[model samples]
Target: MGRVTTEPSAYHRRMAEQKRSAIIDAATGLFLDSGYDGTSLARIAEAAGVSRATLFKQFPTKAALFDAIVTEYWKVEGEGGLDLRPGDLRAGLTAVGRRYVALLTRPRMVALFRIVIAEAPRFPELGQTQFKRGKMPYFTSVRRYLEAEHEAGTVRLDDPELATTQFLGMIADYVFWPRMLLVDWSPDEASMARAVDEAVLTIEARYATSSARPA
Candidate 1:
């Protein structure tokens, strides 16, 4: 009978985490260089200086690895604590709008969106997972601010989810679907800035109540 290895110690666990982070970074570089479909597990393992077996031990499948990369790449701390006070609805929405614009304009973020959209048909749940962990958190963060405004009688949103979706849709429209679909022209800084400004103005116009209007 084969002898089973004992569980890793706390120190070993930390070291393992470091290795996994390194592997993910290496995989990200490869994914960006060769695209997800072009990149292979062996290539990632070689790049990470790990054996194929070790890579599998860390991430069972390509989809699993991609999902981890997606979540980690977009992950932001303190997003759950977005300030939702009752004053300056336009300013508050603009802050959130700019953050979204920044995210969409990032090179890595654009690449990630392309990868996910291309692979989404094969992996239906991929979109759902990304939406749940990535987009949902962002929406929830902004929704908290919206809810506060509603409670304070500054905004009049009966359905916070609908409001959140509408606000995000405005930002999405600025990305230009043809460019996303064809990997054509990237948004310049000036264009992105204008888009963010317009999105904030639109959302505020739709949702702001008397008290929340900018003074």
Candidate 2:
């Protein structure tokens, strides 16, 4: 029985998570196709094949759902912590840079950003929500990672925030931000990998201490 059986609560929780994913997927598509204001929670529930009661139970307001979208878009929940441990500046940054590149280049991520930019004048809350709920937490992890490296003497920085901005800015300026302005801009995987390498090298050049330099 233990081997083949599922606890009712575990099953229920799995089912609940699935429903949430469905709701988010449905809501994202609707938000993309119809715009946030043009879409409604009830419509999202219908598109998701869940009841209005269920959708409201998970997200009471459209803003709440949109916030959820931003959170999910960044995979921000379990990703609150950095993968680095305060050594190997080039290696740590290269890993982080690659992950950042992947996130920035995701199709859904671009759409999520587009929605915020497209609707910013009308629904300023969406932009604020994305910045606070989506951007800050992710950046905080990177900042903390940089701070840890600074403390360990792996990297020397007068201002970590500035360095963090500079490092991530390099990657985004190449691989990510162009998509926002140039409608057809899409760099291939090799280009993205090159961007990551270049950012890592730039940071290593400016920030990594002599001892921290790899052999």
Q: State which candidate has the highest TM-score.
A: 2
RMSD of model 1, in Å?
5.4
Judge candidate 2 at residue 181 and give its lDDT: 81
| lDDT of candidate 2 over 51-123, digit per residue (tens) | 9999999999999899988888776323534667877788788888887887787667888888898889999
Question: Each model's TM-score?
Answer: 0.75, 0.90
- Weakest ten-residue segment in model 2 by summed lDDT: 74-83
Tens digit of lDDT per residue, candidate 1, span 90-165?
A: 7778777777766566546666666667667876676776777667777787888888878877789889988888
User: For each candidate, what is the lDDT?
Assistant: 0.76, 0.87
| TM-score between candidate 1 and the true structure | 0.75
* CA error at residue 36 for candidate 1, angstroms: 5.6
